[model samples]
Target: MSNILVVDDESSVLSAFQDLLGSGGHTVATARRAEAALELLKADPFDLVVMDICLLGMDGLEALRRIKEQQPTLPVIVMTGHGTMQTAIEATKLGAFDYHLKPFDPAEMLAAIDKALESTRLSRSQVVLDPETTAAVAGDAIIGRSPGMQQVYMAIGRVAATEATVLIRGESGTGKELVARAIHQHSRRAARPLLVVNCVAIPDTLLESELFGYERGAFTGATARKTGKLEHASGGTVFLDEIGDVSLGIQAKVLRVLQERCFERLGGKETVHVDVRVLAATNRDLEEAIAEGTFREDLYHRLNVVTIHVPPLRERREDIPRLVDYFLERYARELNTDKPPVAPDAHRLLQESLWPGNVRQLAHCIQRALIFTRGYPIQAGDLPLPGEVGSDRAAVSGLGDQGLGELVRRYLATYTGDRAHEAFIEQAEKLLISEALRRAGGNQTHAARLLGLSRPTLHAKIQKHKLHADTDRQAR
Candidate 1:
């Protein structure tokens, strides 16, 4: 059993974590203040640390900063009594092993500790397994230990030692860049930079300059000779995201870069050459594009030198629980609270969903649910799932333009265009929060789940919308 330190100001929090972890067959220590935790750190070696953000003295963030300053490699899990994105982001920036929102489950926290410990162990030993090596080579994170991910890992291993340009095909939100990154990380040029360019995000007119760089005065806006991502990744890797979205012209230029390993900068006569590994990812079917003549046949063949098609989320439903567990653990750390276990019903509901948005969407959904549930053990009843609730209309109603999605646009329009119901937005959030709670039978976690709001966020909204009283069984 590894020694773990649990720190928080509240005696109840300290006692809870100690009991939770102690019961899990791990050696656990407790400290109510950051200063005490730091002293304990100096005295002995701890495999992992469980810290709180809002401490009595020096605070968690500052204490973390000091801890990192002294031991950069030590993994510190920052647990916040309150769930705040700002705090979580700051903790991540500070290199905390992970952050968790308070009121979190003990089991999830232990899982995070295990993963963080593993990351630390791996980083220290530098003896990454074949799978991890492949994941590093592919530029995508190898998230699961399942058979599908293992195959992806093996593929990366096989192709990493080679120089062939790779075409990664997968549905949206499958982490193609992660695969790209893994390739770069495992390749001979692992130390070199891995540059990325999103082919679809930029305008066609500017893509040439962006990819190939441009000489001074190449265009009206081109004031200085600039190097592009291709040149920047000269000795490293270049990732082209959304490869299928590129126009024929851009595809032709990319083809030239791949085939000849040389391209002239825009308005520059001299040809620039770079020895870079190319990794391309796209969600669309390149064969369909080839048939439609939207994508070049030769270029597709060039990139398809070592094809790696990622399976969609649905096909790998077995990995859902794993992914869900992984993400919930990560988000709980992000929320700076204790990690929460997902209810079996919620897990099944999540598995049953089509997940049309894929992994990214799933991540978003889990995050929303975690926040809503306020780091409690999540359940199907807690989810803002469309079909689960008896009243879909009631749950979706008051979402601004009749849905939560349109609220952003409505807010933007209100701010940028004619003045409108700015006041209504707050009221809508209140009504929505109330309705979500009502549908969830006044279960805080269920209510948050119904609204797809985070615990801290839902808590704040409840207070903001003044729905706390209305939704409460007893008056506050």
Candidate 2:
């Protein structure tokens, strides 16, 4: 549970938040004014702050500025019933994690709180490079002693202090985001916010506005000015994942930001200047994309100032055992169960598997094993079946050799149910949605586009199938 401080003049508002957040297992402290909130903060540590803009004695914006000055990494959510475009912009400039109108939906507020907490964790928590030091630590760690991992560590150390833009390249589930976090955490801007923008997760139409804030009345439905991630992340670092997925127009704008450290907002004439370090990651081959004329060459050159390639898990087989052990221990704690030992045969099976999904797949496998084992030693039978372990390429090749008609005929011959057609459709839908989510890095918006479905539909299907997308380390 986290410690959250709520500052508002209204006693009812404070009591409502206290009840809402308290129900979520967070320790909530209420203060009638910003001054009291600041005093509480000075006396005790808080994981987050939720304050109103019109607090008596001292306003919320001033408190926000002071809080950021005292603790730069502490995330605060600013709320106001009299919110204006200027208030939102000022709050963002003062480093508020988010701004909300009064009487906001409890679910959205909780989601914002969770996002802010996660952001704080990623920025403040240290990413240990030594595998030996990881088992005892509760946070994230890059666990591997292989030569590939060693080189990666060296590269992060050598370039983290510098201002050069870094491009982290790796296949899906290879921990590219971990490298980005390590760089930000060890850099001169470690105390500053590290804003992560998943390019593929956001649609192209919205991506521009997300990076560059929109001016008031810039387009239809533009009710107020909105500050973008780039502007908010000024004086910090912005980790752009799947940078290659950005369109040519957005690429040119980003190129300008890198080249000049300035860009105009959508429909605004003023050129805003920002000082931010850019770290980009992508699983796609930029050279191939450039050749196809879908990616900009100049932008590629700019982002490639420093390159760090994360090797796929198959290339570093020796590290698999360590990774497995780490996940087993980590998930056991999260599952709130005694750590179970891996059977000799189970260990062998894991070591010999192709691991097409790499570390993320292994983590999910271990988590599943722990849940099913029920305090018993984990065995190979608890793991995913052999047919579930290979890459998409292997599956497609097998399908081609068998042909669709023959495959269906074989399944029909073995089937005793009359609802075979419905079963096949359901199975196909589940697999498609799962693979799409995996390819999209657990981004529901992008996965919906890939599957030719709306976001809500995709979300419902995911819920229906009880599928969990590996968002943290997958497609990094």
Candidate 3:
């Protein structure tokens, strides 16, 4: 039998939890306050912790942080009566396994306990990380060596392969969906279906039926029985994109599914049980939505068992070259052509500019440049950054509010001779090689990586261009 700790200020709650969990073939330890709970935790090894948010001495969230600091891998389930968005977000961020409202169903509580224990057991079963690759790739979706991206990769590694609910937060175009996919692809449910639901795209009228399905004759246009995305995602994952936009009513239904593991379809009397893990993403501030009463606090806590924040592209400038290389290769393959090298000035300009739309905008910008280039290296003038700044300054300087595409077309139309093209290509390649070598501090391996070239190929190019390797020591 597993040992469980239940911490609550209310004596009655502690007793009730002890009795309920004790009857289910588990040993239950009760603590009336957070301080006592911590002491008990230090004194003994418990399989799981169920603590109240509104504790007597130290609050549950603070206690949670301390507990995690001491034992990060320990699963903590927080309970609360004053369910607020701020409290839920703070608890989840502090590493709570799950959160439940005070009047939660006993069956739901037991199920949550079971799930947490099962997940914890699975996490310890074997080494999840591949020793050779964990320090390198970390995870499949993440593609950078920056400290910020490394943290993201580690988070994915820790939570994937378990049934923990995950919440990914990031600005638009930061590859949140890619992170979700990586988690699913690496999970035990990898063989099962992974369903995606864009919470903001569907109308409120149809969202419920779309997620929970609808029986025939439930509403107008409901001519046949339809299964919802959630049902179809059984034994798998449901990626809820833009989950901050989910309505309060829908949030309540989602909370029920998280709690009871079952839901009744629209106009259906029978309940359907699902073995689904939820991975939610949003660019919106859910804390503000909760304060505005638009988002439910309980639902936030449930989905945010493990939170992964994806830093925007501007925040991790060092990873830009890698991302640029990846996107350029992808688009080049699609276009059936050799990828053009980015000019040194263009690469530097890209690193210095602010990408408001994040990686997605950068990808599009690269594609647009590729389409416009006539077999020459992409120049600084080719990048279509908005706001008349940096790389885009000269392109839009005299255009007087003209669109980026228009300016790009005008710029491309100026390329007249194949001789000029060859000269431009030669000059651009030399400059790019020099810049890459400089960035790599004269390391050929690093320079090749920066330029998306093989070391041998880069060595050949260096010889062809008659460039010195000790360029990093030279003044810019």
Candidate 4:
């Protein structure tokens, strides 16, 4: 049985914990004040501590600071009858494992204690965090040797061994999810499930029920009781991809889960407590979202405990040769064909080209090139890319040496855009379409011919870029 210390000013609170925890096969010690709790802590070894914010002598926050000073790794759960955002944030920053409202659910309290004990057990293990060796710890799906990637590996090594909430910031397709997986793979909860919830893929209406689950009749089509990602992950990890897309309402609930380890399902009265670590990724700037009032500041702080920024492929072009070889070998084995040689010019072009889609795009390009490369070696001409279109090149011949695509590629190579690929493509497409429409005197047919695109394709592009109405107004 694990030894637990219960500290509170109220006699009933102490008594309730004794009865609740005692039945759960744990030995409990009670302290009426902060001094008493500290005395007990100094005198004996306890697995966990549950303390109240308001005490007879020193306040709980002060006592929490002292406890952490003496036992840095000890997990402390602080509760208050009166809760405020500042208090909650302060408790978390001061290293409290969790902070809850007073008269918290008994089940939630019990779950918190269990998690603390489990974390202690895991932390006590002899496993060490070694940066150079941690890549192998996750089985090498993350292949990179550049300084940028090396820093990423080191961050994973340092953060994986702890229960810190990680916020991975990177452009799309930069393998943010892969970094999340690597963190989970090296964690104490590696044997458990690593559940993923793509925030952008799921609609805002269904995201709440999807994450916190729901009762049998929570909403239409809710025919059966469902376990949410958080509950399902139990002792594992939950990776929230595109986390910036989460709605404000769902963001509040997510903050609760990260803070108190408890959440109630939709249309369910009982709270479902869990012990899940959170790892979230997003291409959007959460700080910007917060300033715009679309995202919660408190939730941002809770998730930003340990930030891991994954560098895009362009920042680490030196690793292209290694990554190319890895992808080529894998695809060759998968296709059951001999690995084709990559011409030196092809490799040079790949390393120099601006990869908007990062590593993921490169891997798919290799696979596609391998399929149609015929014979053996793959050359620069064999690569099928938008920049290689001769028809479009003829259209922008008026621009002299480089076309609009080349200009855009050069701009992307030199610029630092947080959402570079998407923003760059959108801006370039708009500029090209606008220039064409201007040259054609806003005639759709003439503009389409000038750009060497069919009428339907040009119209669709115009609509996609919302240039039809604006350009028509300019033409008039």
Candidate 5:
């Protein structure tokens, strides 16, 4: 049930709304005034806000303004007994989900409530969508020197040596399919096509036809006889992505193809045999899916013959430096710019990032930095760690109780985006110098070299940033 906030001055109307929504299985909070509702809103996020147009003290219009200012994407519904068509138009302009007159249809209001909640959930995270373009999936182009990748490298080595069924598991964007392609590239079947089917992407009905092609006149819209992925991948490997999502019916057929080494076309009665290796990848737990009855147990056992789970990028912090260098060079080449390596502080923060979206998110972050930097040496402050909240919430994430000063400096220095990145680098350099000096026992010369700057330059930066005096260190 969705949590909804209802604001109205009339006790009777509020009670009636509570009775209607509570019976429909929704948790409702009734507020007498806009102040009470605003306080409640600040305490916790609500799915939908229902407000009376004529609120006491603070009108609903003002409350709506404050709500939108705080969270532009939040859905609000306006209810008024004094409803005119003009009120509805104004509410729409202010991003209201719907405007309901007093004594409106309880079912229609409830339906609107459902629509808003569903939309809000989907709008928040890009990670909810599967990402597939990480280095592991980039054929042989992705280069990494991290030790964590050694396991994946070894798996690819073992997988390449066989035509047996292989199961690759990892979180979204972990590059499971990359391992699959590496297997194909090393296999004897490298010359043949490596067919791919994203089991989660296509509709279940269409996926069956996608795997085993339908013949002309087999089903409606079967324009002509077409070979299935199994036939196309004969003498090669066929990759089935998101295998955990496959229907039980489809899983049984897949089992038959694996055991018999053949499958009949959708329209034809005759069985056609094909020599093909199967590679399956998924982010979901097939063991749990089988227990839940969504996946077939026998199919899971068959696919688990050679299971390889690729770890997420955050689990491999050692890889960030190598990935940064690789991305800088690759993107530089692609963009036809000088490949200036990232500065040390920038590299430090990048390595420290806990990439929830894994390599795909990292690649996207780097790509944005590269384009945003425009042929300049990427700085540490240029990093983006947009939080899980509103995508536009803040540039540098707070990192849960991180220093306010650090967050502020990081946010401001995020992108010279408009000015040259050199300007932001200069500001960041001063901050680093002061930090290093504070740690270096007030030794200016030592701090200068530690920061890769000349003593004279450091002295000028000290004066510019107005560093605190600690002159007694000279006598030490």
Candidate 6:
């Protein structure tokens, strides 16, 4: 459970937050004005603070500035019945974790609060680089002693304290974000917010408005002025993940930020200035994108000021055993079970296999292996690796015109329980969805397209099968 402070002039707002957060297993403290909230903050440390913009005395923006000054790491969620573009930008510029309009959905509010709290945790928790330590350490740590990893550490050390833009290049699941986080945590802007913008996850149509705030009536359905991530992350750091996937238009805007440190909001006349560091990561070959005219050459030059290449797991096979041990201990603690011993053959298989998905895939494999082992020693057969005989990949490979009939026959022959028809259908759907997600690199939109289903429908099916739990981290 976490401790939260809610500041609002209205008794109903405080009471609502009390009941809402209380039921979520959090200890709630209420205050009528910003003054009381600041006092409470000084008296005790809270995980998060929720405050209204229109307070009795000092307004939310002023209170937010004071709060940030007092505790730069503390996350504050600002809400108001009357919200404007200026107010939203000011709140974010003042270091508010999020800006929410009043009468917000409870589920959305809770989700935002959870994310803010997590962001606080990450900002506060130091990312340790201690490969020599044999014991498992809590929080995020970059555990590797390989030469390539050593170079990565050196690069982070060299550029972290500077304000130069850094481009981190690596394959998927190679801990690029972790490297970014490490840089931010060690940088001068460590006390400020670190906003992550995923280029691939957000659609191209909406990506511009997401990076640059949109003015009221900027486009259809844009009823209210919205603060963009770049403006909101002022005086801090913005980590752009999957940077190669961004469109040329968006890339030009981002280049302008890196060059001039200013941008005009969508459908707005005045240019807004911001002070923030940019760290970008990408798995795609951006040089190729530039050649193909999909990515801007000028933007690429701006982002490539200091390049840090994160070696994939396959390239640094020496780190696999250490990674395996660290994950085993970490996940064991999470599972509330003792770490199970891995057979020598199992370890050998893991080290020898080509990790196409990199570290994230290996972690998932270990997690699934642990679940399957169920307190027993892990054997080679327990690892549900791709391309194994009778595995999903093996079953689906080289399917011709008779593929559908063969798949149905396989399912029918394997399923022995009652309600076989329903079971078969569900299992088939799960496999198809999972495979599509895997092939799409956990991109739900792309996966949806591949499956010939709407994005929402694909999302519902993913939730039904709980596939996201396994893929979300990988996607990141």
lDDT per residue (tens digit) for residues 1-476 in model 5:
77889999999988988998888888999899999999999998787888998988998888887887787556677888886646654664455655677767787677666755754543331211112333332213434555656777777787787777899988887777667777777777665456667876565667887788666689885544444556645666788988876667788889998888888778788687778889999887676666656677888888888988788887778767766766676677777787666888777778776676888888788888888888887886666766332333244344434775665567676654666556756676777877889878787645744665433345556887888635455323
lDDT of 2 at 317: 85
The C-alpha local distance difference test score for the whole of candidate 1 amounts to 0.72
Give the per-residue lDDT digits (tens) of candidate 1, residues 1-476. 67888887788887887777788787888888888889999998887888888888689899998987786656678877675646764775565755566566666677767755653443233223323223132211346666776778788899987898999888888778777777766778665556667775565566787788777688895544555667655666788998886778778989999999999889988787778789999877678667766778999989989988777787787878767766776677778887787777887898887775678888898889888888778888876656653243445464434555676676666565343456556666677777888887775645654554433345556666666533343111
Tens digits of lDDT, candidate 3, 56-117: 77998899989987865567888888877567657755667666776877886787688667
What TM-score does each of the candidates earn?
A: 0.54, 0.80, 0.54, 0.56, 0.52, 0.80
| Inter-residue clash pairs, candidate 2 | none
In candidate 5, list every pair of residues with a backbone clash: 136-178, 346-380
For each candidate, the alpha-carbon lDDT, in order, equals 0.72, 0.84, 0.76, 0.77, 0.71, 0.83
TM-score of 4: 0.56
Decreasing lDDT order of the candidates: 2, 6, 4, 3, 1, 5
Q: What lDDT does model 6 reach?
A: 0.83
Quality of model 2 by C-alpha lDDT? 0.84
lDDT of 6 by residue, 239-356 (tens): 9998887666788889999999999989888788999899999887788666656678888899999999999998999999999988888788888788899999899889888787
For model 4, what is the alpha-carbon lDDT of residue 104? 78
Measured by TM-score, the strongest candidate is: 2
| Candidate with more favorable, higher lDDT: 1 or 2 | 2
Off by over 4 Å in 3: 1-141, 390-476
Clashes of each: 37, 0, 0, 0, 2, 0
Pairwise TM-score winner, candidates 3 and 5: 3
